[model samples]
Target: GAGVSQSPSNKVTEKGKDVELRCDPISGHTALYWYRQSLGQGLEFLIYFQGNSAPDKSGLPSDRFSAERTGGSVSTLTIQRTQQEDSAVYLCASSLAPGGNEKLFFGSGTQLSVL
Candidate 1:
């Protein structure tokens, strides 16, 4: 992909449904990040993967939320037993380096709605 790519731009589901969001980063970017934006939460950092190892999983709200990166390129975020509170725009971003402030290329995001 020429840039960060997120799939299923919009997802609507009933409460208790599970959802998976995908992100394919730029070919050479080694730092991938997951964030969620909602009117109530603002922008929250969910997780970050450097290469295939995740050094930062602290941002995830609970055990129900998890993410993983494979082959140092693509990443997936899974939300189990969706709640209306979990509805938000899930965003993915990548940077050339492993730092919070590094310039990033962001995907459009997946808007997940739980009713």
Candidate 2:
């Protein structure tokens, strides 16, 4: 089974442009989450979706950031207006549940570079 995978392993974008990063989670995973890791900083939660419940987008840095999970599997993160500060590793993870005890399987993120 595929653990998790991200596209464009590396991305270089101009400022004010938009980019879409894709993620394919493992089969049968019910919980999907997106997080950003800047330089040496810790992982920051962005958005999460579980089954048919409303997505938790509280962690999204701004309105420029949005995401959607389709068919309870693949997910995509889109940045409306890219900025230099937005350059970071956009990681996607999935788990059985959103519990602290459950280990999140992480995907090799899409490295976005805003020039």
Candidate 3:
């Protein structure tokens, strides 16, 4: 793809249901990141993957949230037992480098809404 791609741009699920958001990063990019942007809130880092290894996953609010990157390309974010407070835009970004503040290309994101 020319840029990052995300699936199910808008999702409405009942509380306690589980949802999975997908992200496909640019080809040849070695770094993938997941972030959450709540209304009026700045982007919060959820996880980061360099190559095939994840060096950070500390930003996830709870154990109900998890992510993984496969083959150094696509990534998925799974939210279990969704709560009303979990509503937000799940954004995915990709960079060419492994560290530092490299320019990131972001997807449109999946807006998860827990009703």
Candidate 4:
């Protein structure tokens, strides 16, 4: 896909299990972001990565969640010991620049379900 690509479009796991979600952004994009959106809720920022610099993970719900961007292109989000409440649609987006407003290209998203 020329736009952002996400793998395992849907995931189902038992409580306490671990899952890894992958996102491959468009080539040459410098900024990438992860967001979580539960049913009927708005997008919740999870993390932001800009180039080789440090990532902002303040939006992570808990210490069990972590993400890393490799080569400023592909980013992976890891959730350890998943809970039922963690079920949501995980969205990945990329922008040419970092800011509140930019032309962001979003992926189809990974829907996670914890049973």
Q: What are the RMSDs of all candidates, in order? A: 1.0, 1.3, 0.8, 1.2
Per-residue accuracy of model 2 over 54-85 as CA lDDT, tens digit each? 36889999999988888888888999889999
lDDT score of model 2?
A: 0.89
Q: What is candidate 3's lDDT per residue for 31-99, written digit by digit as tens?
A: 999999998998999999998788999899999999988899999899999999999999999999876
Q: What's each prediction's clash count?
A: 0, 0, 0, 0
Each model's TM-score? Answer: 0.96, 0.93, 0.96, 0.94
Ranking by lDDT: 1, 3, 4, 2
- Cα misplacement distance, residue 86 of candidate 3 (Å): 0.5
- Candidate 4 lDDT over residue span 56-115, tens digit each: 888999999999888988999999999999999999999988877789999999999999
- In order, candidate lDDTs are 0.94, 0.89, 0.94, 0.92
Task: Kindly list the per-residue Cα lDDT of model 1 for residues 1-115, writing each as its tens digit.
Answer: 7889999899999999999999999999999999999987788999999999999998999999999999999999999999999989999999999875799899999999999
Candidate 1 least-lDDT 10 residues: 96-105
TM-score of 3: 0.96
Q: lDDT score, residue 17, model 3?
A: 97
Worst 10 residues of 3 by lDDT: 96-105
The C-alpha local distance difference test score for the whole of candidate 3 amounts to 0.94
Off by over 4 Å in 2: 52-54
Candidate ranking under TM-score, highest first, comes to 3, 1, 4, 2
* TM-score, prediction 2: 0.93
